[model samples]
Target: MDTVKQSLKEASIFTHSQERPFKCSDCGSNFKRAADLREHERIHTEERPFSCSHCTKTFRTSSNLRQHQRVHTGERPFTCSVCGKGFTQLSSLLKHKVTHTQERPFKCSDCGRGFKSSGELMSHKRFHTAEGLFTCSVCGKGFNRSSHLQTHQRVHRFKSSSNLRKHHRVHTKEKPFPCSVCGKGFTQLSSLLKHKSTHTQERAFQCTDCGTGFESSHELLIHQRVHTGERPFSCSHCTKRFKRLSTLRIHQRVHTGEKPFPCSVCGKGFTQSSSLLRHNVTHTKERPFKCSD
Candidate 1:
């Protein structure tokens, strides 16, 4: 009882001290205590000590890890008070609570972009850095963001040929983005996000100072490299800079002369399957893009 009284007295003294000692160097933000300073340090460091075992993914905090584990365990403890819809995490409930308050605290620093939750900001950051780590094994293509890779992989899973053609158009469009040094084109805003990394020399997707900046933000990352100069996808022995791994494979043929694509009508050899795919249409007199039939 005496110990409790002493602790209470110390707390009262702190409240009266008028001291705000904890200050952040990166954002110039202030905190009331040292512990908060340490916690806030993780934002600048991008260090996530907590990790999930299932997918071998890392999270910044234990609370995020606990929330993620619920997805694996199917534990939906949070429920809507009015609708009774369940979520595996309390954060989900808080997000659902936004429909009631219309509160959006999280926002983008590079742009005036706002999100209802921090997770949304987490997802949104993918566009600024253009870091996509996941890859499609069959095509040997990488993406900066998982959601974009998810969206692209779905194109391959599409059962309809018509849908596939529509999906293919996304790969060959003239979409544009702001130029950090030189204005270039990108298929997704996230690729532009990763491209901005090249001009800023800002590799937020780094492992260390010696670590590289090659995390993927979208599938078909050929559109991402107008920003940075580091070319990771290369032939084991040769020196070549390719924006896409698929292009690097095609370039390797210059050394090997190994033509995988052959024209059906004339039996002519080519280095790329895309070249063959486009050439075959010419031989068949098929302007697939302009077809009225």
Candidate 2:
């Protein structure tokens, strides 16, 4: 009881004096007491001493651990008065309230685009700068975002001998994901869900620029690139670029002399599928186009 009283008295004295005696050497953050400075130093060291009782998750601060407990408990104390929506954190509730007001305080200097948060505006600025901080070591592909580079690197792993063994299931006609509705089977769960959407004819994601609807947000992003003229995929050999990575890969094959497509009738190889299609038509002796007088 005396220890607790002494600590409370020190805290009161620190608050009254408004003096921060302890300072962090790394970030230059000032703390009222030595204990607070110790807690702040853990952030630089990436130390998580505070562990959650319910899960395996750990936090650097006790306050963060307490806030994370709300995830398991589903306890949302912060509520928005406008929409009556609840949030676990007060900061989240404050951010949500901005949507009700339709006010975008953060603006991009390059494109004059508005964002609800400063973080979103900062992310948007990277597109204008074309900041390629992350690069794939295998194909030397550059990406503005680290997450995009990580996803692109998976393609290199998929081409490996070990991954090729697992990929042989595609040629062997293997279907892992089965649909409950129509009893249709797909190689992937995402493919199964996309096939299910065909029956519903549901296009949930809408493009803000063209007002075109798509089944997924990924499809919408690709469609938006047409309006934005953002060609992120570039060829390593030449100055040629493409809107999609698949197209860029096809373009790179021209430089690499990779002829995957072959004419089945004549057994002649071609660099592109379109060239193979044209050669196949020669065997049929059918002209697709006729000159008009």
Candidate 3:
């Protein structure tokens, strides 16, 4: 295989030397091989010549076509040795292998945080840069991440003034609605009403399979997902799924390393607001929960 070795050696030399002899006439983007340049030029022309035999889908390159064919064949040739997880592409397998080792090759210069991939590190770096890639048209508040901006925009979608005020209590840490039975405070009147029902032993919502009773319809729905074994919320980054949307949203912070809830005293960040509340008690030495003997 002298021919194969010679081709590999030439490719190595070209990569190291950064010698791109072939240049595109349209964009002036350089490529080492004429075929690669031609394939790239198809982006400008919108030419997808390579058609899949199984389906009507087409790709610009034969390599992409072969990769697409694996979907129909269910051929996952690239398998992780550690986890035994299979991937259609070698690149995806390589990315998955990093998770097993817990090795983060990419590091953020600003916060000194590490990430498994360059894409994750780039997303993390944007937090320090103050670049507003996503902006709210209503309040004009800028957010670096699109997800954070989308979450912020939900505040503006409140139909009633009372609903908007109830939501604002979360940020202000004000609980005006107090339960008459247990004297427990809640941000929203609906939550306070739900708490009052629990004291009265009101089983308004009952499960079909299980005899478990919930005070609210939302609690019943969440409980039903347990028996059904259905995870409706899934992480966009990975294959990890969750029963609740709130849990999935919190899990996404693990990938993004986004700690929105921070302790005021220690400045320690947490994925959940409840975790931050728990941590805040340590600073005040407040034991809110007690057992009566």
Candidate 4:
């Protein structure tokens, strides 16, 4: 009877009781448990107590650190029963499960649109409100979102007609600017300038682990990942992780069956541009690789 009473008391405390004894001094947020208050206080203090063994990244909670470690291990414990899809986090799996359901619990009052979650409905409500309205002065174009206006404003950034004509190369896929070192074509002069640095053999950023030099800090950070064994980018569809986000994006194409690269000669699609280039050699009867033995 005493055990049953204790269980009932605990259940009531979680479900019905509003009394929270533990309070955060920084945020004034109340919690039923001291551990909860400690976690909440970290947000205000900007304290990251838990550190990852594999990398320099740190987290406020041990659970977050454990999740971060999965990036290196490429572990996806959460699996969907319907499609057999894997996700790194349980919350992501839960979000994926909503796609299989036809039921929309939240309905928008403004447009009568149905959404699976309350967060979606709230985002939809923003379109009906003037809360995020933005306008462009150059073209007098209106956008419901500020981000759309910012992207549209880029067209107006180039004041001169010659600069605007140069920017049009991005849409036309024109590469007038060629690198003097490798003869590699680039659409912009700025890209050609950056490409020339690769041939200079002047790598300013040096890695402490292997004494490897990189042209830029970004390149150095990516090279450091080799020594750290850190693969930060994880595929949403599978347990595979990648050191680079671009590699992860390419890996996702396997799951999505998206072949963006197409052979102009054969109209055949390839998941990667390199694959298309290799297939093009078949038409030319060029055997680049041969067995020496």
TM-score of each model, paired residue for residue: 0.32, 0.44, 0.59, 0.49
What RMSD, rounded to one decimal, does every model reach? 22.5, 21.4, 7.8, 11.3
Tell me which residue pairs clash in candidate 4. none
Collision pairs in model 2: none
- The C-alpha stretches of model 1 lying farther than 4 A from their native spots are 12-19, 94-293
lDDT of 1 by residue, 1-293 (tens): 99999999998998788777788989988877887788789999998899898877788778889988987988888889978889986766888886556466777898866666565555556557654555876675777544356567775687888657656658777465565678787655666777777776664554333444554534324444554565778776555577676677667656544554546675445667778788777657655676568
**What is the C-alpha lDDT profile of model 2 across 133-228, one tens digit per residue?**
558899887876554776777677775785665566678888878888888887766788888887899998899887899998788888999999
lDDT per model vs. reference: 0.68, 0.79, 0.84, 0.80
Model 4 TM: 0.49
Candidate 3 error regions (>4 Å)? 1-23, 51-57, 100-103, 111-113, 158-161, 197-293
Name the runs in model 2 displaced over 4 angstroms: 1-19, 25-29, 44-47, 145-293
RMSD of 3: 7.8
Reference-based TM-score, model 1: 0.32
Tens-digit per-residue lDDT, 79-102, candidate 4: 999999988899888877887887
Question: Per-residue error at 116 for model 3, in Å?
Answer: 2.8
Which scores greater on TM-score, model 1 or model 3? 3
Sum up the clashes in candidate 3: 0
Locate the minimum summed-lDDT window of 10 residues in model 2. Answer: 253-262
Which residue pairs collide, candidate 3?
Answer: none
- Clash numbers, per candidate: 20, 0, 0, 0
